[model samples]
Target: DAVDQARNFQEMLKFDGAVLTKLDTDAKGGAGLSIAHATGQPIVLCGVGQEYDDLMQFDPDWLLEQLFE
Candidate 1:
């Protein structure tokens, strides 16, 4: 459903990239990967907390660490 919605939004907006929010939650954020694969656009940013400063550039290494650790 998220992939489908992302595809639809991509068609309408033609966004260059995505900003994934709520990374501090229990969610492993596999959908971010799915949406990126579906839209062919990278996730440029991620919100790790509820503050503005928590927004950070997307880092593949960090995601890998989180996934493996």
Candidate 2:
């Protein structure tokens, strides 16, 4: 196994505060939820659009609601 070479995603997790770019979409927001939960981190922001100002902060519950709705 490449366990020794495996890099921890903690830095990415801490830096992101939950808003993962790869999962930035209306659907499948669950992916972000899972990552945050698994890493025991909180989601404070999300960039769901293609603009600097589009990047916005969100509560975990609100993100979940968006996905659910």
Candidate 3:
């Protein structure tokens, strides 16, 4: 569902990149990976928490660690 939604939005809007938010809430990282793959776009940023300062650059290794941990 999320993948399709992301793909559709990306196609319609033609966005250059994507920001994956609420990773702190979904620690598994499924949505992030799926959306990135479906949209064929890089995840340039990730939101770790609610605070503005929680935003961080997307790191595939870090995300994989979170997913497997």
- Best-fitting candidate, measured by lDDT? 1
- Local accuracy of candidate 3 as per-residue lDDT tens digits, 1-69: 888888889979988778988999999888888887788888999999999999999988998898788
TM-score for each candidate, following the candidate numbering? 0.93, 0.61, 0.89
Candidate 2, superposed: residue stretches over 4 Å from native: 1-7, 11-16, 22-26
Q: Scored by Cα lDDT, where does model 3 land?
A: 0.88
Per-residue lDDT tens digits for candidate 1, residues 19-42, read: 999988835779999999999999
lDDT of each: 0.92, 0.58, 0.88
Candidate number that wins on TM-score, 1 or 3: 1
Itemize residue pairs with steric clashes in candidate 3: none
User: Residue 57's C-alpha lDDT in candidate 1?
Assistant: 99
lDDT of 3 at 19: 91
Rank the models by TM-score, top first: 1, 3, 2
